[model samples]
Target chain A: MLALHAPASGGARLTAVNVAAEAVGLVIGDRLADARARESELQCHPADLAADRAALRKLALWATRYTPTTALWADGEAPDGFFLEVEGSAHLFGGEDALARDLGERLRGFGLDPKVAIADTVGAAYAVSRYSLQRLVIVPPKGMRDAISPLPLAALRLPADDCATLFRLGFKRIADLIGKPRAPLTARFGALLPLRLDQALGHAGEAIRPQLPPPAYQARLRFAEPILLQEHLIVATTALLEKLAPELERDGVALRKIGLRFFRVDGGVQSLTLGLASASRDARHITALVRLRLERLAEGLDAGFGFDTAVLDGLAVESVKTAQPGLAVQARALTEAEHRARLVDVLSQRLGAASVRHLSPRASHLPEEAATPLPALHGAPPAWLPPPRRGPRPPFLLPRAEPAEVMAGVPDHPPAQFRWRGVVHRVAAAEGPERIAAEWWKRPETPSTRDYYVVEDDAGRRFWLYRDGLYREAHPPKWFVHGLLP
Target chain B: MAPSLRPAAPPPLPLARTPTEALVNLRQTIARLEGRPVAEAAVPVLRFGCPEIDDHLPGGGIAPGSVNDIVPVGYDATPAALGFALALLAASQGPAALVQSRRLEAELGQPYGPGLQDAGIDPARLLVVSADSEADAQWAVEECLTAAALSFVVGLLGAPLSPTVGRRFSLAAQNAGHPLVLLHPHDTAGSNTADTRWLVATAPAARDRFGALGDPRWTVTLQRNRNGRTGQWILESGHGPHRFRVVETLADRPLPAPATIRRRR
Candidate 1:
């Protein structure tokens, strides 16, 4: 006999018990000492609620294979059940009965004994699945009222104290309150009984929040023989994309974001997401992008044993107009802009969108703030204005300025010599003191004004240096090497 | 002895209608024997617009579909090498890509936008790819070469590339008909299969009439050329985009200034 115990105010109490412990009459909430005395061979372990909750969540995510909408149901603290809204998806598995049976078989294969219930209403399904004698219950449409009428009041998902009060008032089963007047029930129970009854009878609607948002469009495939090779996965992906292509074309829509999920036989799931530079319904183009992402996975996909199911979902889609081909002798090929967009999509998939970027000019005098890096997938950048012909800027700019030691001839003169990066360079020629004041209007505190200079060292390697502030400040102005010039 | 018979001069070369056509046919035969794609006669060449430098290069310029390497002469000469590479890209008028490993970016500095504009290359037409490693950087360079819209691709690597990767890059560039320029540090020791290899160093800039700093100068040496002569020249940036002027040979001029010029306060 095995049991899990948790700390209680009085002492340690058994929170859960296995079949053998239950067979030996060891009930939950019993004192651990008493349970040990009742069954001398009983084994007890401490309960970890947090780990249980996380595992349950992972299991719920895995259940998304049956239907896109899967929610977790909790009774007291942690989730103990899953709700799959297989209303329209049941036909894919042959029927509601077949789906429930398949779910049971799969869960049992994972060493779990699951009780599944399919009903027209959430309240009725919850009551029958928990209190019914059979492990699998199917409450047909309009049969919810009769199916859950024999169960006890606790099956209504009411408070334990309320159940006791209703039992004390001679209301033992849900059938006792089926045709009773609501005014006395509301006055006696304060609206809980009437609301639960109405919900169970399919009069009041209930909504289940799914673990993940339902995809705009999705295609699924199940393999008879599990496969582990990457080539096979690619083939499967191509087939799935082909299936989705016709539908997308018919709807005149293109996918902006696609998610591919691999459901391994060992109950583990792996997912990859691809973002396109532009909306595309072309299967070949999207397949190529997916192949690039697959090749670049650092550790590769772990198909632990093998994966039996694959799902392709279009997470975000947009409507696109199809262009009619002109009656010309030759069909038109992709334009230059379209070709560039494809290249951007390929590079972004392999290296990541953030790594592939373009520079756009910003209206700022500060060198670093003069341009911003935009992701290439965002589209072509705007035309850049010609740089003002003030002084030449260095082709390479340091991420930040490094302080330098300087020896100047006059209080306001440029540096005669500066020591930077552990080397002292004698200045051969100097060109600046291009004073740029800080934007005081944009900030609460006024920053120090900079005096920039273009200096050439004796080696003919040019350096861009700047003095932090005026020489008359409390501390003498400091020098910093800001960039390297060609 | 046999009446000085030379087989009637091989039937006057029946396959040749013109000397240029005959040369092209022979070149194609040789290329097939080498298991390489036949070089097209119409491949575009990027000229330096300076007679002194252009005269030393084959076809009077560098081919757009060939791989080239630029190595800095010293640690301080990296910027000069970069400047020369950018001038080459600017000459090939179209969109370009710059690929570099993150380590290299940290060691050197990030390519500044304003500075790129100052070098006569428009910042908008350039794509920057920051790879995680040296291999990724090379891969990105090869991928960029496959794009027809890009005129050229440049990769700055801190580590030397293996010969196999270099050969692959050359083949890709040849097929795509795009130029590829690779920049290496002074300490890189591995050999590459480039059409031309240049060694660059900074030279003192000439002042204008008012005694202000003028165009930047570099002493560029053609250390290796597969099909042309190798030489060195002092070149400086010219007045317009993608233009350079040959200053003088090393023997024709003396050092402009001493190593250290300390003026009294």
Candidate 2:
């Protein structure tokens, strides 16, 4: 006999009890000491509500195979149950009865004793699944009221105090409130009783928040036998893409993000998401991209037992114009822009989109702010303004300027020499003190003004150095090497 | 002599007409053996536009569809090598990709946008790939070479590459008909399959008429040439129509004071 205990105001109370513990007269909410007295052989453990909810969520996601919409029952302290909106998907599993049986059998295989219930409404299903005597119950359409009428009033999912109040008022079954007038129930139970009944009987609409949003467009394939090899996975992916491309082509739409889901036979799921730089419906191009990603994960894609189902979902899509074939006899090769876009897509797929970037000039005088690196997938970079007629900028800029030791001839003049990175170099020539004041508007606590200089060392290697603040300041101005000019 | 046997040596086997022609023939044979295209004329050349440097290079310039290596003379001279490589890319007349590893970026810094524009390269035409490791950077360079739209690819690597990887890059560049330039640190050692290798160091800049600092200058040495004579020259930027010009050699200039004396002063 096993029981899970949780801390309560009084003491540690049993939150859950197995059949044997319950058969020995140890009920939930009983303190651990009393429960031990009732059953000396009882084993106790602390309940981990978080881990339980996570497992339930995973089960909910796995249930997506039967239907695209599944939601965890959110009214309880911890969600121990979930709902599957399988009205449209039941036919795929032969019937509602077969779907429920299959679901129950699968859950049982995972060592879970599941009580499956199906109805037209989520509330009715939730109530019947928990309160019904049979392990599996299928309420036909329009049969929700009769199926739930005999259940206790607590099955309406009201608060325990309200249930106790309703019981004191002699309302034991849902049938007791079926024919009642709305005013009296609202005055007594504060409108929850009538609302829950209306929701369960299909008079009111209740929205189910699915774990995953439905795909814009999706294609599914169920294999006759499970396959585990990477080669087979690629083939399956290609086939799924082919099936998806036509649907996208029909609507003159292209997908920018694709999600490939592999449902393993042992109820594990492996999913891969591929993002494209440009919207595309070309199955071959997309398959090549997917192949690159798969090749990268060749050793990591664990196929436990095998995957029996593969689903390709277009998570994000955009409309695109279909190009008409040219009258020329032979097709033309890819244009320069197309080649560039394809290269970005391939590189981004393998090395990730963030690593590939294009530099664009920003209109800021601050050296670091003067330019920005943007992901290459963002399309062609904007045109840069002609370079200003100032001292040349260095080809390489340090991420942050480093302090340098300087020896200057005059207080405000360029340094005669400076030491950087433990190397002391004598200056051969110098340019200027191009004063750049900090933007006070941008940063309220403005930094000191900088006196920039273009200085060349004796080796002919140019550096962009600057002196911070004025020489008269309490702290003598500091010198810093900002960039390297070639 | 035929009566003396050997059929008169088969009419001297049609010997090469000139020494240069024989050299070209030998180069083509070597290229073919290395799985490179044998047609010399079909390969495009980028001339330095100054005859002094151009004349020493085969075909009057370096081939665009080949691998080239640029190494700095010392750790401090890396900026010079980077400058020379960027000038080559700018002169290539198309978009270019620059691949650099994170370690290299940390050591030498990242490429700046306004700086590139100042050096005559449009920032929009340059794509930068910052890889996490040297291996990934090399892979990115190989991938970039496969794009026909890019005229060239540059890899700024912090570590030396294996000969096999270098050979693979060479083959990839040749097959894709794109030029590739790899910049290595001063300590990098070992042979590569590059068609040309340049060792670069900063040279004293010549002041303008007003005695101010002048255009950037580099003493570039053609350390290895598979097809032409190897030589060294002082090259300067921002002078001639080309990206670089040959600076006139000063025969009687006095050497500057030694570093120790300069520091004492």
lDDT (0 to 1) per candidate: 0.84, 0.84
Q: Quality of candidate 1's docking, in CAPRI categories?
A: medium
Model 1 TM-score, all chains together = 0.89
Best by TM-score: 2
Cα deviation of B182 in candidate 1 (Å)? 1.5
- Candidate 1's residue-wise lDDT over A1-486, tens digit each? 899999997999998999999997989899999999889999999999788878888888888889999888765312477789999899999999999999989899999988889999878888888889998999988999889989999888777788899899999999987998899889977877788788888889778888889998999999999999888999999999998999999899998899999998878889999988788887888989988898999778999989999999999898988888789979568877777888889889889999999988888887778888899998786678888877778877888888999998656798999999899999888898788888787778868898899988777788899998887767888899988887
Error of model 2, residue A1, in angstroms: 2.8
lDDT of 1 at B234: 82
The positional error of residue B141 in candidate 2, measured at the CA in angstroms, is 1.3
Give the count of colliding residue pairs in each prediction.
0, 0
Question: Candidate 1 at residue A389, lDDT?
Answer: 72
